[model samples]
Target: MRTQVAIIGSGPSGLLLGQLLTDAGIDNVILERATQDYVLGRIRAGVLEEGMAGMLDEAGAGARMRREGLPHDGFDLTFSARHHRIDLFGLTGKHVIVYGQTEVTRDLMDRRAQTGGVTVYEAANVQPRDFDGAQPYVTYEQDGIEHRLYCDFIAGCDGYHGPSRKAVEGRGLETFERVYPFGWLGIVADVPPVSHELIYSNHPRGFALCSMRSNTRSRYYVQCALDEKVEEWPDERFWDEIRRRLPTETAEKMTTGPSIEKSIAPLRSFVAEPMRFGRLFLVGDAAHIVPPTGAKGLNLAASDVRYLFDGVREHYAEKSDAGIDVYSQRALRRVWKAERFSWWMTNTMHCFPEQGAFGQRIQEAELDYLAGSVAASTSLAENYVGLPY
Candidate 1:
C-alpha cells in the first residue's frame, strides 16, 4: 500500500492529522492496534482551547461540539474556603469549550468516514521503518498476515508507549519527566455540576477539581495518595470526601449520586526532545505530556498538528521544507510553556508532603496575591484559556 502519510494509532491526534491531510488532497492511512470501541472507551479530559476548537472547525467536525459543548468564560479558584473567579474571557478575550476528548475523537472519526478516509483498526505490530532515509514505510501484521505500507512521511501520533517514539530511542532521543507524589481519584456520574463553571479547589487534605462532560454528566476528582486504590473509595465515600474539600455552600449545593465510572490517575510532566526524526514526526503525547493541571494535553496535540500540517502542506503546495525543518523548535517552545504552567498549577494547588507548612503558606500567599493583583490574575487567566498557537 502507498500513501502520502502513514499515521500510527487512531487517537484524536492521528485521526485529526489524517483528516486534515485528506481534505487537503493528501493521501493518508491510520493504523490502530486497538478496536474502535476500545479507542472510544478510554476517558480523557474535555477542556478544549479556542485553538483546538478552530482546528475541529477547520476539519468540518465542529458542528456537534458547537451544538452540545459547554463554553466557559471563567472558572473559580478556591482556597481558605473562599472562591475567586478567574475571568478567562474578561482577561484574555478568549474562552474554552468543555467538550470530552472522547467526543472529539468520535467527531473526527465520523468526519473521516464521511470523507472516505482510511483507518485500519486492530492493526498488529505496527512499526515505522527507514524514517532516517528519503524513503519511509510502515510494517504491520493483520489477520495473521504481514504487510508493508510505503508512505512519503510517517506521523508518530501513537503516544508515549507506542512504537513511533521507541523506534528512535537510541538515535539521540532525550526525555525529561517529573512524577508527582499524588494521583487524582476521579469519577463520572449522571448529575448536574455543582457550579455552571469548573471549580479548582485547594485544601489541606489535598487538591480537588469539579468538572463536567455535559450539563447532566458531572466529573469530579480529589487528590489521593499515589498508592491509593479505587477499591478503597466507594461511591458514598467519594462523594463525602469531595464535599468535605469544597466550600460549605458549594458542597451543600452539589448533587451526589452513584458514579458510572471511576479511576485513579497519577500526575506527571514529561517531554521528549526533538519531535522530528528524518521523515517521521511526533505529535501529541508522543512528544510531550502535561500534569493536566491546566488542561493542556489535547491542546498541545492540536498545536503540534497545526505546525506539522502547515509544514507538510507547504512541502507539497510550495515545495518548501522550512516548516518541517523547524517543527521541533516551534512545537517545543509552546510545549515547554504549557509544561511550566501545568507544573506551576500543580505546585500551587497540590499539597506536597515534604514541603510541609511552609509550602502551604506559600501557596496561600500565591493565591491570595492573584486574588488581589490584576496582573497576576491575568497571567493565570491567559495560561488557563491557553496561549497563542
Candidate 2:
C-alpha cells in the first residue's frame, strides 16, 4: 500500500495529525497495535489546555467537547488547611476546558471514519523502516499476513513503549528521565464534584487532587507509595484517605460513592532530544512525557502536533522544507519549558522521601509567597492556561 504519510499509532496524537493532514488534502494511514476498544478503554487525564481545545476545534472534532466540556477559569491550591484560588482567567485572560482525553480520541476516531480515512487496528509487529531516507515506509503483520506500506514520510506517535522511539536506537538521541518515588491512586465516580473547579492540596500526609469530568462525575487522587497495590485500597479506604487530605469544610460537604474505575499511575518526567529523525518525526508521548501534577502531558503532545502539522502542511503546500527542517528545535523548546513546570509543580506539592524538615519549610515558604505575590500567581496562571503555540 502507498500513502503520503504513514502514522504509527492511533492515539490522540497520531489521530489528530492524520485528521489535520487529511483535511488539508494529504493522504495518510494510521496503524495501531491495539483494538479501537482497547485504546479508548485506557483512562487518561481530563484537563485540556486552551491551545489544545482550540486545536480540537480546528480539526472539526470539538462539537461534542464544546457542548459538554466544562470551562474552568481557576482552581484551588490548599496548604495548612487554607485554600487559595489561582485566577486562571483573571491572571492570564485564558482558561482551560475539562474534557477527557478518552472523549477526544472518540471524537477523532469518529471524524476519521466519517471522512473515510484509513486506520488499521490490531496491527502486529508494527515497525518503521528507512525513515532516515527519502523513501520511508512502515511494515506490520495483520490477520496472519505481513504487509508493507510505503509512504513519503513516517510519524511516530506510538508512545514511549511503542516501536517508533525504539526505531531510532543507536542513532545518537539523548534521553532524560526522572521517576518519582510515589504514585497517584485515582478513582472516577458518579458523585458530583467536591468543588466547581479542581483543587490541588498539599496535606500533612501527602498530596491530593480533586478534579471532575462533569458536574455529576468526579475524579479524585491521593499520593501513595510507589508499590501500593490497588487491591489493598478498596473504595472505602480510597474515599477516606482522600477526604482526610482535604480541608475540613470541603471534606464535610463532599459526596462519597462507589468508585466506577480505579488505578494507580506512577509519576515521571521523560524527554528525548531531536523529535525529528530524518523523514520520521516523533509526536506526543513518543517524544516526551511529564508528571501529571501540572496537567501538561496531553497539552505538550498537542503542541508537538501543532508544530509538526505546520511543517508538513508547509512542505506540501508551498513546496518548501523550511518548516519541516526545524521541527525538532521548535518542539523541544516548548517541551523543556513544560518539563520544568511539571517538575516544579510536582516538587512543590508532593512530600519527597529525601526532603527532610528543611525541605518542608522551603516548600511552605514557596507556597506562602505564591499565595501573596501577584507575579508568582500570574506566572503559574500563564503556564497553567498554556503558553502560545
Candidate 1 regions with alpha-carbon error over 4 angstroms? none
Per-residue error (Å), model 2, residue 109: 0.7
Off by over 4 Å in 2: none
C-alpha lDDT values of all predictions = 0.95, 0.94
Measured with C-alpha atoms, the lDDT of residue 126 in candidate 1 is 94
Query: Relative to the unseen true structure, what is the C-alpha lDDT of residue 95 in candidate 1, on a scale of 0 to 100?
Result: 96
lDDT of 1 by residue, 355-389 (tens): 78888889989999999999999999999888898
- Model 1 root mean square deviation, Cα atoms: 0.6
Per-prediction TM-score, please? 0.99, 0.99
TM-score of 1: 0.99
Q: What is the lDDT of residue 49 in candidate 1?
A: 94
